[model samples]
Target: MNGVLFDSFQHNSWATKVLLKVCSQLSAEQLATTAVGSYGNIIATFNHIILSDARYLHHLSGNAPEWLLNRDLSNDFAVLEARADEAANNWQQFFTQPVDGEQLTILVSGDYEIHAGALIAQALHHSNIHREQICAILTSLGIEPPDIQPWAYAHETGRGRDLPSEQ
Candidate 1:
């Protein structure tokens, strides 16, 4: 894997952990609160964000398995977290294997194709944007989000801190 892609995976994992921390801070009652009424509450928005990104990531990689299809966030944190872990693992495994790094076609939609690296980049970038939203939700709820920057973790734990900064 390229250095950039590897860094992306690390960052993605870090961001994911931080989001989980934010979610962990919520109470069952607070988790369902809709601060703005129209924003669909914290749980729903977080659920949609995770599921939508996973769906698009899978679709772009030509691996849109039914198991990874849309899901309800209200189900349970365990289920949603499991699915997220699976999605992240799938991406990680794919990254572990060597790709041409040159170019490869992926199913963008009905008969559409996009470069693999570009698609992966899109997925990572898009998720990070939503992750920030999740962090904001945490702050609004009076919960602090972990510092996901590489330097923070490095400065805190040296090298063996944790695989994902969230942990």
Candidate 2:
């Protein structure tokens, strides 16, 4: 009841928030570092991911958060985390609706329309790809990023329990 049946939105937010916290500890130069295949530096990538999330959520629910309009909350971890929280709440609210995946929705102004399910899928997929990019950047820096996989989210949030191995 908190979100969609699988609630990937919450996992998406949690995983990104976890990555954001890890990135917060980096020095300025480190944060600004980007790999050959990444989307700009860590800060810029985080900005893109969070802002795009707001946009996708806005398209879905018709409620736009201030970040989508303002676009000035850059590289500020506190602000980013707060914005992520607001986005998570909005997604939770959206999931509560009687949504139909087959319904058509406008992706962007004047852009072609797509199935409602595709929009949601894109949002989750986008967040994931960028997070891995950051992880790659971190690996290049010799830093081990925290595990933000769905299983890690499940373990941290008690969504799953492990059993001991048996012979």
Each prediction's TM-score versus the true structure = 0.71, 0.93
Pairs in steric clash, model 2: none
Mark the regions of model 2 whose C-alpha exceeds 4 Å error after superposition: 1-6, 164-167
Q: What clash count goes with each model?
A: 1, 0
Instruction: Give per-residue CA lDDT, model 1, range 1-167, as digits (tens).
Output: 45557656665665675666558657887776554433466677667666766776666455654554534454466666676777777667666667654466655555866677676777777777666666666667777777776666455546445466674
* Residue 161 C-alpha lDDT in model 1: 54
- Candidate 1 has an lDDT of 0.64
Scored by lDDT, model 2 comes in at 0.87
Best by lDDT: 2
lDDT of 1 at 28: 81
